[model samples]
Target: MNIPKWILDVFYSYLTSELIYFDGEYPIATPVATFFNPTKNSIILSTSVSFYNKVKCIKQNPNVSILYSKHEYSGLSEKPVVLVHGSAKVHEKDFEKNNAYLSKLIEEQKETWKKEVYIKMGRELDSFIGRRLMDWYMLRILIEIIPDGIVCWKKEANILGSVDDLSKTIGSVKGDAVFAFMGEKYPIGIPVKLRKSNRKFLIENPTLNLKEGQKACLLIHSHNKYVKEITLTRYKGRISRISKTSRISRISTREGEIGEIEFIPTSKFSFKQGGILNSIRFILDGKRRAKKFLERYKKT
Candidate 1:
């Protein structure tokens, strides 16, 4: 499908997108830095070599979906929420070449990079320390997603809040959440209404394609209206039919049953905020993690 220019513009300016890839059992979504590489005619994203799960999944199942939600610090809240389904090509053949490509990409978006650094670290983009302490982030493996389909939600302006809410262990059930599962070739991602009770959550019927035992993932995230605070959380689990009848309406364009499903999340991750000590710990942990990855890279 030919991507509209407006969607391409969102790809360029959007701060972060939820990159959803299928694991062997279920779909998993993670927040990733994105770049619209015009030359490649694809969306380029880099993941740390230490993050083995994401890289491994892309290699196993090339089908992926990227949600460019304007609710985050993307600064384009007025624009429609866009979802892109694409086939991914992992570019880890040459680490140095990948690193250089990412460096140039970052340089082109220097101001945006600085703003994100300030927001996340409460500091300026200090190159010396960054080069020394953040080498793990630089030791990257790139993934390019060639667009196959693009869809948009034009009127989702109310989806903004502090990441603190959705980042909690028991997140706020309000706001928009994306549910993803395998489609024919590309994984399908669509926003669904979220409801929680105890540990298990409920979402209105999203699609008829979902099976009882199929693996799926739900991503709940938003930012404040001012675009300062952001929250992102993901839950991965298998699907089961809900026993009770549901009053929720169907949301997907695909023909499906109008009943609910029980989403028993086996695992979850919340992108939350921390204090100064936590930030220090985060960098130290990254350094330690980088050592292992770098050591393995050398052996290879």
Candidate 2:
């Protein structure tokens, strides 16, 4: 495949740059070791770190923007630059699938180079370790960078002369603006409510401090849009039914009174200053209480 020279240059420059930032936040950037052609129009660039955290950020807030430019190189007219802005998500399965294709590409390159070495050596040596080495080498993982949008600037002028000029020279010259063929520039959030369509269960108490393995009844308040009634229970199992149609009728512990509890999906809830273990405890306890209540009703 023919790779654009401008893209190659930009990738090279970015590799040596100090850092990439977003809204004063420093995002981790690693080298794109191998590129995988997953589909006819898509390519995945491998990175050093797992993008799970980044995907979480995008899911939580989709509004994201990025700018790339060379500050040190000012002599070149029409400085090479690009900006990209788009939403991102983590797809574990897709990433793994694409990485497999990239492995094949890496092997092809290695084999081509090995042939040249074999020709120079004039003979093949013992091949005992060949299979094992190849297996170990191909086990490396790769990250996939799926580009949403891109902007680019050309460096040189075309046959159109001044009209096609990208630089400051004898390029495309329009009426008021002297159009020099300038190098190509490739430039390139929101919270969504978790509803039943995305996932079931309403999280009413998002800020309560619950210990790991503790029991609590998740009371769903139907009247209030945001307020969910959570009841702390001492039992541990499954919630068959949760209602927010009326005020919560059960009270459990000092955390708060259980007014009708609403259920929210765990994926939609964000922890302000606590771990997920506590959240899981709250959910499990609520489920357990609901199961016990159902059992008592059946017995009665």
The alpha-carbon RMSD values of the candidates against the true structure, listed in the order shown, are 7.8, 23.4
Compose the digit string of candidate 1's lDDT tens values, residues 1-300: 456666766776676668888788677777776877776668888887768678888899898888876444545545566777778999987877997786676555534533354344313223677767676666778999887666555643222222121121121122377887766666766666768868888777532456677788989876553334556788888776543345454333323333577778888888653567766776777777778877876898
Measured with C-alpha atoms, the lDDT of residue 14 in candidate 2 is 33
Residue 5 Cα positional deviation in candidate 2, in Å, after optimal superposition: 6.8
Query: Under the 3 Å rule for N, CA and C atoms, how many clashes does model 2 have?
Result: 58
Clashes of each: 3, 58
Error of model 1, residue 172, in angstroms: 22
| Best prediction by TM-score | 1
Model 2, poorest ten-residue lDDT window? 173-182
Candidate 2, which segments miss by more than 4 Å at Cα?
Answer: 1-39, 47-51, 61-79, 86-89, 94-98, 105-148, 153-300
